[model samples]
Target: MSQITISNAKKIYHDTPVIENLNVTIPDGTLFTLLGPSGCGKTTLLRMIAGFNSIEGGDFFFGENRINQMEPSKRNIGMVFQNYAIFPHLTVKENVAFGLKQRKLSKQELEERVDKYLKLMQIDQFRDRKPENLSGGQQQRVALARALAISPDVLLMDEPLSNLDAKLRIDMRQAIKEIQKEVGITTVYVTHDQEEAMAISDQIAVMYLGEIQQIGKPKELYHRPSNEFVATFIGRTNMIPAQLLHKDGQAYIRLSDGHMIAYPALNHLEDQDVRISVRPEEFVRSVDGPIQATIKDSTYLGLNTEYIVETGFAGRIQVTEESTLDEDFGPGDIIRLEINAQKMNVFSADGKVNLLEVI
Candidate 1:
C-alpha cells in the first residue's frame, strides 16, 4: 500500500485550466473517493495520478517517491475502467493471468496467482467462460481479478459500477469495498454518484468545477456541511430564505411568515439576509409546531413517506416521515412542521459563509 500525495496540481486544455492548484493526500490502504458532477475534473485528476495525463505543474508522489515523469506501466497501479475492459477472446483465467505473464513469472507461480485472484473475486467457477457467456456482474469480477492478480501498490477505479443495474450496482459496491479492505491496497475512486461515494469511501473529496469544495467522512460532510453548495450537493436540503435579527444579545432568524426561530447567538449580524438549510428528514410533523404548512404532494416509498409541503415561511419544503399505516396525509391537508435546531445549518445569503462557524 502507498500513500498518494498531490500538491499544487494543475491541468490545462488549450490554455484553459481544468484542474487548478489542487492538493490532496490519500492515506495508505484507505478508499478515497473523488466525488463531483460531470466535467468537474475528477477523472482528470485520477488519470494524472495513473500517469495517463501530464501535470501542468506541481508534484505527484507515492509514499515519498516522486513519480511525475514515470510511465503509466511503471507506476505499479492497477486501474479498473468503467466498462469492465476485458478481452472478448480470452477466458476468465487467461485474462487474470495476462499481467503475470507479462512479468514472465514461472508457470506454477503464474497459475497459482491467477487461481488465487479468481477465487478471491468469486469468479473461480466461471474461469473457463469467455466474456460473452458471463453476466455484467461476472464480467466486472473478472476485470477486478485481473487487476488484482499482480498485487499492485495502488488500485484506481473510475466509476467501475456505472454499467450495472441499480440492484447490481449496490451489491457490487459492497463487494468492491469488502475486496478493497481485504487487499488493503491504496485506492482512489472517482464517481459522480453521491450515495455510492458515501457508502464505500473512507474519505471523500467533493469537487466542483476544478476545485475541491470539502473533504471529510460521509457523515461529517452530510451532517455538518461547511456551506450551501456542500449541503445541497451532498443530499436533499430545503434552502429557506430568512433574515437574521438581534434582540438583547440574542440572535434569531425571522422567517417570511413572521416566525422567529432562535439560533446559536454566534454571528449576530442584524438585518442580514441568510438562507437556512434543513434536511428532509430533519422536519417533524407536530400538532403545535412553530411552522404551519399544507401538504402539496405525498410519495409513498415503502419505509418512508415523502411529502412536499408548501410552507408560509419557505416556498416548498420536502419532509420525509416514517410511514405509519394508520396515519395518512394527502394534498391540501394542513400540517405543522417543526425543525430540529441541532440539525439545521444557516448560511449567508450568497451561500458562502457557514453561520455556525461562530458557534
Candidate 2:
C-alpha cells in the first residue's frame, strides 16, 4: 500500500535549483535505489522524499496521501542513515524499542516488538549491550532493527552499508535483500556505489546534474543504457571514435583502428561520425581479428585478466578476458581483437542519444 508517486518534483538550494521537474514512481514492497555520483543530487532527492527537505514545486505522495507538507515524523517512515544513527547511550533492546514507545505502545507490545526485530536482524545476543560496544556491522544491524521495529510503511536508507568493511558490506547487503523481501515494505535506498546498487536494487534511478538520467533493472542499465552518460556511469566502457557508413544497403562502422564491422541496425542512419561503447568483455582476442594491438600491461585477477593495449588508431584501450592456464600475453605482445557488434552500443557523436533500438 506504500507505492510512492512523485510528480514534477523540484528542489532549490539558495536560489540555485538542485532538482527540477522530476517524476518517478516506486512500486510497493520493492527495493528502489537512487544511484549516482556524490554531487548528482541523489541524496537531495531522497531527502525530499523523506519530507526532510521542502519540495520547491512538486507533489509527493505515499499511496493516496500527499505528504509534501507533512512532518517527517508523521509520514510513518523509518530512516537508517549512513552513520548508523542508533543511540550510544541506549542498549540494543532499548534502541529497538524507542520508536514503538514513541507511539505509546503498551509495555508487552513494545517488548515483543523489540524482541521480534532483534531476532529478525539477528542482533538479540547484543540486546543488553550499547552501540559503543558493538562492531560496525553489529551497530548497523541494530540500526536496521530499530528502524523495522516501528513497522513503518516506507524505509529510507541513505548509504547504510558504506561504513562496514568490505566483507561485511557484502554480507550485510545480502541480509538487507532478504530482510526487505520478508517485511514487504516499500524501501528507497540511496548509494553512490554501482556494484552495491546492482546487487540489491529491484530498480535503480541513475541521477546526474540534478536530473535522473535513467531508471531500470540492473541488467537493463548495464546492457542497454539510454545515453552515453548512463552507459559510462553504470559500468566500465571504452568510448571509441568511429564512423558510420552505408554501403550496398548495409550498415558498417569503421573503428578508430581502421577495422570496419557491419551492424545491420545502423542502416537507417545517415553516414556520420559516431562513438562506439565497448565493454571490456565485448572484445574477443581472436588470432585473425582485424584490429591489431600491443599489450602495454596485464593484470591477472583470478577470474579474468585485464589488459591495457596500445593500438595504431584507437590509442590505448582496456580489454578483459578469462584467464587461461596456457595463455599469458605479456607486455609488448601483439594481439588481434574484434568487437561483438551484437552487444556493443553505438551513440551519437555528442553522446546524448544511443542509436541502437532497445531490444
Each model's TM-score, in the order given? 0.97, 0.98
Give per-residue CA lDDT, model 1, range 1-359, as digits (tens).
79999999999999999998999999999999999999999999999999999999999999989999999999999999999999999999999998989999999999999989998899999999999999999999999999989989999999999999999999999999999999999999999999999999999999999999889999999998888888999989999988888887788888888888888555355568999999999998889998888999999999999999898876688999999989999999999978987898888899987887744
lDDT at 197, model 2 = 97
On residues 1-359, what C-alpha lDDT tens digit does candidate 2 reach at each position?
39999999999999999899999999999999999999999999889988889899999999999999899999999999999988989999999988998999999888889989999999989999989899999999999998999999999999999988899999999999999999999999999999999999999999999999889999999998889999899889999889999889999999765678999987888899988899999989998988888999999999999999988766778999999999999999999998888889999999888888634
**Model 2 TM:** 0.98
- Model 2 bad stretches (over 4 Å): none
Residue 165: error of model 1 in Å?
0.4
- Where's the lowest-lDDT run of ten residues in candidate 2? 350-359
